[model samples]
Target: MQGFALYPFDPPGDIAALRADLRGWLTVNQPQDDVVARANCWASFDAGFSRALGAAGYVGMTLPARYGGGDRHLLERYVVIEELLAAGAPVGAHWIADRQTGPLILRYGSEAQRERYLPGIAKGELYACIGLSEPGAGSDLAAVRTTARETAEGWRINGQKIWTTGAHFSHIMLALVRTEEESERNAGLSQVLIDLDTPGITIRPIIDMAGHHDFNEVFFDDVLVPHGALVGERGQGWKQVTAELGLERSGPERYLSSHALLAALIDAAGPDPDPAVASLIGELTAEMWTLRQLSMSTAAKLAAGEDPMVEASVVKELGNAFEQDMPRRVQAIVDCAWEGSDDLARLLRALLIASPSFSLRGGTREIIRGIIARGLGLR
Candidate 1:
């Protein structure tokens, strides 16, 4: 196993003031939705709230100012993301665009593509979905079989993408496709920007156990896009997508999915609680603090332009365990009905239902553990 050091998470500027300001802003702007909505809050979509956040200069914090971004430091953006997730803000509508797609485009997209997409993305009105998973692919992105054949007219795409979150509502999709004929595994693949409204494209929702239509199935049949839709270098999609996954796996969202349940538990326990409940709260808090430190260190490494793939996998793996275990632990000790109506009971039920998908979203447990093992020279 390789030894790892925690990078310093010191961000320039008054982080205290920044957090205070954002808290104040959220106080005035955040909607008082159902308590259940606060659990897995990132999946709570609200387009109007997203636009409001963008208008407040919180949407595209790290992108260059020329593209209507805040041009702030990456850690500063990280602080904002932390605050938003902690507050259970309904940021689902523009989450992908702000988190990874916008940055990915800035890094590998064409000038025209940047000019066309970045502005809208910064505004938070435009949305994007990742087109990496297929029926059997899931987290095994290397197994992607989607194809995009270049023709005189344009690039004709014909394949299906499954479990694409927000595809039904997104404006665009950044897809990995087999660009070179006879390509196998990750070779000869390229990223392409596809407008969701393009002809011959179809999107159908797949409701989860929670009855949310966040995931979808996207289909492309002879769908043609311009030659410029290809992002970065051809035959380098594997590298680009790997970098994008680093961004996806290391954020605070990995652990904060069931935070509302924790908050509700604390509230239900009150300031003076039974010894066992107090002990449980202390343990959960300690675990959360540790995860935050790991995630912050990983984010700092990324901000310094280094790939912390191993550290990120570590965060994702541990964070997923923390989140999935939290609700079950709470249910085990708490005296709450299975379908209770109180805030604590409601949040507990909601998180228990949502917990199963936490490990599956960024990457499955087996995949994340495999990445960590490889990083340790064991694979």
Candidate 2:
């Protein structure tokens, strides 16, 4: 189908209602203090907050109603995600499960798998992380060496995954492993679900330069999982994961991580504002708005069951650039010290330190651009 079919990114009438309801619910339930919300937005790991969100019917907005989901359109979910990120709510706890995992299970999982996992996920009680990146294979997923050997009992996985976000706090891991022997890169790959508490598995936290501990290195030394743990067909991991990456890389989260900082910059500038600062903010805002429209279009494609790899890559590349650029550009134009007005300064300092990873996560800029190039038939 042509991209123009999803041309308009404007929210539908129901989507507007969703936005209003979510906004009102968040105002009453989430932290009223701007700094707290600003600091937490999507990155803060708060299980209780996630549970609250799930209970409020905001967690699984798109999954079928049969599996405890809201059975709404993807755009409805998009609105809730936008509000959460804009408020900087502590959504990290259930972000992965709600965003991609639930859909993955709904799409590829068996009846039993869906029955067991989707309900907990919709309830925000089950947390999962992607086990794709490794020490040698971060962006080049085909280079992954993690192997899962099938056994009479189950699959024995032996490999290591690095930079697994929220792995320490997660209950399950959807890991991509090589299941076929001597197969070339991108072939023989399969995705497996493993319980984090299973014996023979170890997790060590990787503290970032910002002193945060969300990243981790997970080791699987003959870790065993039941056959039910496999997500899809045995040797179709590459296909499944690529489709999943379309879900992972394209979203409001890709662009909204530093949104709090952007708002803070405006506050710091006050009325009249510096002409240079206003210009910079206006430029960034315009870029963000364009990216949002592109992102909404991508989401619409997904809603229509199309794997918009090229479009998703474009959004991710441009979104990452904007996210990484916002803090540095703001710092160049404004006072970044933590003194004087504390709110904006604190938000700026937090984001300034966190900005470096904006492009690194959700696939690096280099890898994203490569995907875009290939998508454009330039390769």
Candidate 3:
């Protein structure tokens, strides 16, 4: 194909084959109980499950075959993610790598960088974390103070990154740093890959409001990285980072997080759906389907080499809000006890406890709203 600009694949394009294959594969090789364990703990800690996903060829579906990938369509990756989330599969171990870093690196990294990192990412043998947020820089990405200066060997990095999810265990941290001081907030910034074991690097797990240490604060003191560590052109981090955020924000993951409890609530309605409850479930399901379509379309746009920035923002804003509110609805439907002997009760117990952090994690509501306004030309 000379270019995909003229003909983008249809959203949710011909997923029948992929769906059937994934179903069969998962049926025979479903994850162990430890894979989908809920609450403060997750599958991210399970090396076995991560390896199994790699072995099963489900880790980096969209990457090229040379990198241990399946070379599947992006929509196929969508199907895989949907299956895992719907099944409540434990995927915490490789989630960040599979979700963001792999795709980000594949798109902007040098050929050597791609060859070096993508293979292990494909096999789920390597883990990666993003170092974007800091204690004072949440949502205002331009405020990140981490600095990297040219050194005889390469670059010397210094400063701290906070709210780096899974940093405690990740092998690599792809961090955004100020390459040179500029009067403009977004000027002279870049993204670089840092080895977690580099000299003078310290990672401290920060307990989230959820009372879990899934996130961390990483301090880098003169951590040296080769010049190749930069993912894209230096001073383009402002642009590259936003593009990466589009991928981060637009996906099934945005709304699928609360699906288990939503399904449970419908299950509690019994043999005959309660008219009111049925309508509520219908509304939620319709929203999920719509978000899925929008997200799929955004991927198709990206594959066609067109920026789906606006569409991605719409998906992120709506889908994240929808997912964030699902647990609140669950809590409102019944008492705080959630003692009913039903599937909804069990799922609600978990989702309710986990709901509060949903909005704050990926992109805060304020950040998303600003993006939406800018996209709409209302800002």
Q: Highest TM-score, which number? A: 1
Q: lDDT by residue for model 3 over 155-258, one digit each (tens)?
A: 99999999888888799988989998653578888999998999999988777654666888899988889988988898888898888887787777777777
> Candidate 1, TM-score vs. the true structure?
0.99
Instruction: Tell me the spans in candidate 1 whose CA falls farther than 4 Å from its real position.
Output: none
Give the Cα lDDT of each candidate: 0.93, 0.86, 0.77
Q: Which digits, one per residue and each the tens of the lDDT, describe model 2 over residues 1-379? A: 2334454555456776777888889888886655835653666888988999999999887888889998877887888898899888889999999988899999899899999899999998899999999898977879999999888999999999999999999999999999998987999999988889999999999999878998999999999899889888989999998888898888998888888888877887888888999998899999999888889998888777778888888888888888888878877888667554587777777777887787888888898888877766686
In model 2, what are the clashing residue pairs, if there are any?
Answer: 41-88
TM-score of 3: 0.90
* Global fold similarity of model 2 (TM-score): 0.95
Pairs clashing within candidate 3: 44-92, 44-93
Tens digits of per-residue lDDT for model 1 on 20-68? Answer: 9999999999999887787788898999999999999999889899999
Which candidate gets the maximum lDDT versus the true structure?
1
Off by over 4 Å in 2: 1-6, 10-13, 32-40, 338-341
Arrange candidates, best TM-score first.
1, 2, 3
